[model samples]
Target: MKKRFGLLLALIAALVMLVVPVGNTTHAQAADNSLEKIQKKGVLVMGTSPDYPPYEFQATVNGKSTVVGMDVQIGKKVAKDLGVKLKIKSMSFDSLLVALQTGKIDMIISGMNPTPARRKNVAFTHTYYQGGYDIVINKTDKAKYKNKDSFSGGTLGAQTGTTQYNASKSQTKNTTVKGMTSQSDLILALQSHKLDGVAMEKPSAEAYVSNNKQLAAIPSDFNMSSSATSSAIAFRKGSTSLVNKVNKTVDQIKKENLVKKDYLPAAGKYLKTNTVNTSMTHYWKAFLTGIEYTLIITVCSVFFGFIIGILLALARMAKGNFFKNLLRWIATAYVEFIRGTPMMVQVMFVYFGLGLFVNLPALTSGIIAISLNSGAYVAEYIRGGINSVNIGQTEAARSLGMSNGETMRYVVLPQALKNIWPSLGNEFITLIKDSSIVSIIGVTELIYQSNIVRSDTYRGVAPIVVIMVLYFILTFTASRILNYFERKMQHD
Candidate 1:
């Protein structure tokens, strides 16, 4: 019997080795079979920011589910030209750039500029739309800002990641430039008198001033380095074929004046009519801080939750009718409640609502909320793993005069944990991302950092991109660690 049991254990371990494929960094790159994969998959994923009007915006037209804007139209044309279905993945303005770098999407036609930093990671097609920065001020203050120099010492606003943001930050030596996430947001701030003036691309500014009579573009010599920051399409580095195709298509569209007829008509009402300066360094430090926060929150939540989850799983699996069933129900209810609700609500509940009831510290609230939310799912994963253990092994251990505790501790639990390891790893990956929700509670997690950067710098895209990269690193690292343990256990 002992020999048979040992053979069975060896067989189980071997099976585990075959089942769990270890992680590899190679998956980060686009496959050589990219084109074929798309042809077979029948869909082309494109990244764009839905909040940037005339570029991308949420709209329900004639009862149709659609996100309409300039970039959306451009995306449609590009996809149609490629003879593939287009699927838009709406994300923050900054994440779209990383999506291109990671090859998660084929291209970005979201009115992106060809910056030196961005060019290092992704290639750009010909300038599809002419872009430049424009300075905007409250109607009441427009008379004072005749030129860039006049606005010295005044507070200015610019959307993060835009050339306008860089220009305003660099050129306005005396002025404090507030960076935000979107042009619309900047305009709103200007109108609300929260900002003295705003520097934005001409097309985007024109779009705003045309709609709101309370704002006007400052008539200045328009001190900016570039004449027009030619907006272009972006693709992953080394994707020569895709880049070439987009370049050729954009040229054809431009030559045919289809950009005016199709893209402009669909989105022109949304961009600024004037041009503004472009620059590179637009609040990089602030953006980096946001990414740091996101990483910290993800790590803390997953670590704490893992410990609590194991304990809860053990309790749920206990044989007693009361504690076991009660724990099982509790775990089920917790998971269902969290999974059923929006993460945003839960974040607010913990951060704002619960705090009012009890004066708990912010860090404590953040950790508790994230752990509670994550622990529920972890419990289910642990339970599944425990249940996977063969019943015969437990019975045999008991028949051998082993106590129930000894059988569970020495014979059953180890095997069960190994089986459920993958699920637990997957849960951690999810937790790493879901932790972003805690940022709403002002936990200074990655997303919150982005918000702060936007609040201070008026630059939205760069801070958001930083946050996305931070999240990617966290998830990627978690995935690798999980795979490492899974592989080690299997091989052993």
Candidate 2:
């Protein structure tokens, strides 16, 4: 027991040593050449959550859907000043900071606040937009609720991981605070009367109320410091050179009052156009793009995941030597670790954690993460299938002068796969649905496109129902194909 414990401690210490240096190296690199690198690349990538209207949201320009709003305008200005072309990457609001820190983006301008807590992890520029908070309630309850204080016994909703969310939980009395990932979801809840109010930035609240006549906004009345209400661009930690350069543009915007006179009015026009056609059919292109990406991710992940599963399943079943035992132990540990954690965290880790070493596009990262996750589960199924094979089959192959590898390759594996075909088919179908988790990192899959539709049209349920039917169509078609293959195999 003592020897085993010591060995475990040594393994843990080795992992820690491996992890610590990567962080230090990333920080050291970020401390310098931040501006030179962007100029050399000739493109400044700005990451933002495009679900927040008038701050940053999707809009149609020249009949092409794209990310727009005041924050995007600010990003364009910063990129122009740096003499680099601007590339906007739309993701969830909660992922912007991680994407910046991991170098997935050069900077973040997603209506994000520069609170002291966030400052510890990433560098922030001077404030570009100073905004306040508001609580949006159903217009019918506009008279009953005056402010945040009015929701004493009712539930309030806010986007998870925002300043307003934290404040709603900490500052309110006897009020139940509900957190959702998107502002559209919160507003949908309010419209359904599930929530008494939804707290958000003043501009967003106003936009929602104006677009949806059933909603009205009131002051949140929560005490806040300037840092909590102010928006700034964030870069990787120690990117002082880049932050200082971008501060010049932020200062110019504030001095010229461009946010009020220019950006807001421009974004409002898009909002008007967006509301003009809220019908689902108007956004078929968006959903089609979504289906294309979703299919790509699922198919790629399934093919690679099957290959990985075979290797891992073989490694887990290895025996007869010290090296084989070690391989088996490592494979078992990997399978357990993956199965224990959530797929969402794995997606983020692959995109952001591996990003420190090499830059990967969001689609590539999603495929890699989902493939790895699916491989672990598939390995277990393969292992069970192997176990179900009769020992006499292996003996029969060996007696016929077959080597161990030949036995597995020509005899055992083929039969084992036939036995496990149904399970593998189920895994493939499950992956079709599970692929939606990748949208958190902005892969532009079905769920992500649906979110853009929700934000664009301001009609939540229609987009959701459309995606629901689309997903069912995908899964149902996949199931029929799998069944046809199964029948063919059984006949053979």
Q: How accurate is candidate 2 locally (lDDT)?
A: 0.87
lDDT of 2 at 210: 91
Cα lDDT tens digits for candidate 1, 1-492: 000012222333344334323342244243444445666777888876555545665443432324567777777877887789998765545445533443446777666777665676577788777755667787787567886778787888876766666677677678887877655567667766788887766655666566566778864345554323667777766666666676777888789887668776666532322112111134455446655765666678778887777777777665667768887777667677886866655554554344433655445666778887777778778778778888999999999999988998898878987998888788778876776665433355565545544433333355556667767877788789889999999998
Segments in model 2 whose C-alpha atoms lie over 4 Å from true places: 1-31
Please report, in order, the local distance difference test score of every candidate based on alpha carbons.
0.64, 0.87
Estimated TM-score per prediction?
Answer: 0.54, 0.94
| TM-score, cand. 2 | 0.94
Worst lDDT 10-window in candidate 2: 1-10
RMSD of 2: 5.9
Clashing pairs in 2: none
